[model samples]
Target: MKTLTEHDIRSSFVNCSKGEAKRLPLPKQLADIDHWDALDFLGWFDLSAPDRSYLVAERGDEVIGVTLRSPSAKRGFLRRSMCSLCLTSHPGSGVSLMSARKAGRAGREGNSVGLYICADLDCSLYVRGKKQPAPGGRMEESLTVEQQIERTRGHLDAFLERLFV
Candidate 1:
């Protein structure tokens, strides 16, 4: 992944109005995020609009972005939840049900897909051993770490593509 600027992020949005994209927040450490190798994509929540979030990932040379909505956490309800994107389980504060409105007119007509995603959108870091997975969060996997990372990125990329296609 290449280092992306705020402009890259803003212009990359495919599922939100320009005004909304302009208002979205960049990750606080974006400029200082030198460890691009540790990230499969970039995601962040807007502090002012807690319900709003965004994701951007580079596919080939193109940067793709999607706007997401953060539903209120259903705390203590689903005790053993796994993120649909990364397959990382969260016995505690590890996942949030995030939804993305479909792109173009379908979105305006109320089409969307919701999935349990890492609450902080830090799955890449977690998968790479940079961050600790919550207790009881680990899943049994025969795949090597590199293979798991590849699988996670594949799932995430395919999910993001759904908003546009």
Candidate 2:
């Protein structure tokens, strides 16, 4: 991943209207992101609308974006959930089911694709050890860090592919 501008991010959205895209809030401090190269995609939950989230990634030569929604339901504190992308386990509500509206006709028909993901949208950082989940939340894995990164990206790519199907 490379550093991206607000224009680049705003124009990459595939599932929302231009007006909506223009109005959608972007992550703060876009120019200050120090981990761009470590990211497979940029994802953030909207502060004003807690249920809303966004993700952007580069696929081949194109940058693609998607709007995601998460339910507001609470989870049991003793339960742990794993992100499907990075396979990192988080306690309680640390994992969320983020659903993105499908692109094209399916989206217009209210179709969406959902995946259990890190609630903070920090899968890249978690996998790279730049961030940590709760104590005892991380599982020991035989896969190397590089392998885990590749696996995470592969999972994200597959999820994005579902948007076009």
Worst 10 residues of 2 by lDDT: 132-141
The C-alpha lDDT values of all candidates are: 0.83, 0.92
Q: Name the Cα RMSD for model 2.
A: 0.9
Q: Candidate 2 residues 107-158, lDDT tens each? A: 9999999999999999999999999889876689999999999999999999
Instruction: Provide the lDDT at 142 for model 1.
Output: 90
- What's the distance in Å from true for residue 116, model 2? 0.2
Candidate 2: clashing pairs of residues: none
lDDT (10s digit) by residue, model 1, range 1-165: 788888999999888889988977788988888888878989888888877888898877899898888766557845777888778788755688889988889888999987779888988987887887877676777989899899988988788778766
lDDT of 1: 0.83
Which regions of candidate 2 are displaced past 4 Å? Answer: none
